[model samples]
Target: MAETVFATLTTELVHTRAWPSGHELETVVFSPIKGFCGPRRRHGRLGNVSPDAYEKTRHESLTHS
Candidate 1:
C-alpha cells in the first residue's frame, strides 16, 4: 500500500504541469475515509462526507480557476 501511494506520487510529480496542485484523480474519487484510518495528511481534519458531497467538493476544486 505504501509503495502504491509512492508510485502514484511519483507519477503525479512527473505530470506536474497537468496537475499543478498534484491533486488530480483518475477515478470517481471518494473523500478519504474520515475515521481512525483516514488519509495521512487529512487525518480527522474533515467532516463526514457522502458521495454527493464528495462530488460537489471535487467539482468545486476542478472549477476553482
Candidate 2:
C-alpha cells in the first residue's frame, strides 16, 4: 500500500514538473506528505474519516461500553 501511494506520488510529480532541483523537489513533496500522513488527513481505510476523528470515535465507543 505504501509503495503504491509513493509510486503514484512520484509519477504525478514527475509529470507535473519539468525539471526540479533536489531542494525544490523536497519542498514540493514534504507538504503533501505531511498533510497526507497527518492526523487530519482523511483516509479511505478509516471509512473516509480523519485519523483523529477515527481514534476519538473508537475511544468513545470503548469508554462508553
Candidate 3:
C-alpha cells in the first residue's frame, strides 16, 4: 500500500508542473473492510485534507486553471 502510494505521488509530481515544490501532498489509506465510516484508527500522523464541502470546488479550479 505504501509503495503504491509513493509511486502514484511520484508519478503525479513528475507529470504535473503546476504544483509547487513546497506544496503538501496527502495520502489517505483506508481499510478495505472497515472503509472510511468504520472505526477511526491512527496509524501515523494525520495530514491535511481538503474539506469535503469544498473538495469539488478545489478540484475544478485545479483542472480548469
Candidate 4:
C-alpha cells in the first residue's frame, strides 16, 4: 500500500511537476500499523468514490462519528 501510494504520487509529480520551481521533492514513509488491514479497508471503502465525494464522505464520517 505504501509502495502503491508512493508510486502513484511519484508518477503524478513527474507528469505534472506540480511543486514550486525551486522546491525539492521529499518522500516520507509512515507506518501506523504492521499489517495491511487498515490500508485494505481504506482502499476498499474509498477507492470507488470520486475525490470530491470521498472528501465529503470522509469529512462527514470523521465529524459525525
Candidate 3 lDDT score at position 33: 25
lDDT of 4 at 52: 57
Per-residue lDDT tens digits for candidate 4, residues 1-65, read 97998798668755565544433443222233323333333544577655556787889999998
In every candidate, how many clashes are there?
Answer: 0, 0, 0, 0
Better of 1 and 2 by lDDT: 2
- In candidate 2, stretches whose alpha carbon ends up further than 4 angstroms from where it belongs are 1-32
**CA lDDT of each prediction against the hidden true structure:** 0.52, 0.86, 0.49, 0.56
- For model 2, name the residue pairs that clash: none
Candidate of highest lDDT: 2
lDDT of 4 at 58: 88
lDDT of 4 at 9: 69
* Per-model TM-score versus the true fold: 0.26, 0.47, 0.27, 0.29
Q: Which ten residues in a row have the lowest lDDT in candidate 2?
A: 13-22
lDDT of each residue in 9-63, candidate 2, tens digit only: 8888856767658888787878777877787989999999999999999999999
Candidate 2 lDDT = 0.86
Say which prediction, candidate 3 or candidate 4, comes out ahead on lDDT.
4
Better of 1 and 2 by TM-score: 2
Q: How does model 4 fare in lDDT?
A: 0.56
Query: Residues 15-57, candidate 3, lDDT per residue (tens digit)?
Result: 6654344433322222432554333433332334424424556
Candidate 1 Cα errors over 4 Å, as ranges = 1-47
Off by over 4 Å in 3: 24-65
Residues 10-64, model 1: lDDT tens digits: 6764555454343454321233433323433332234556445566788999999
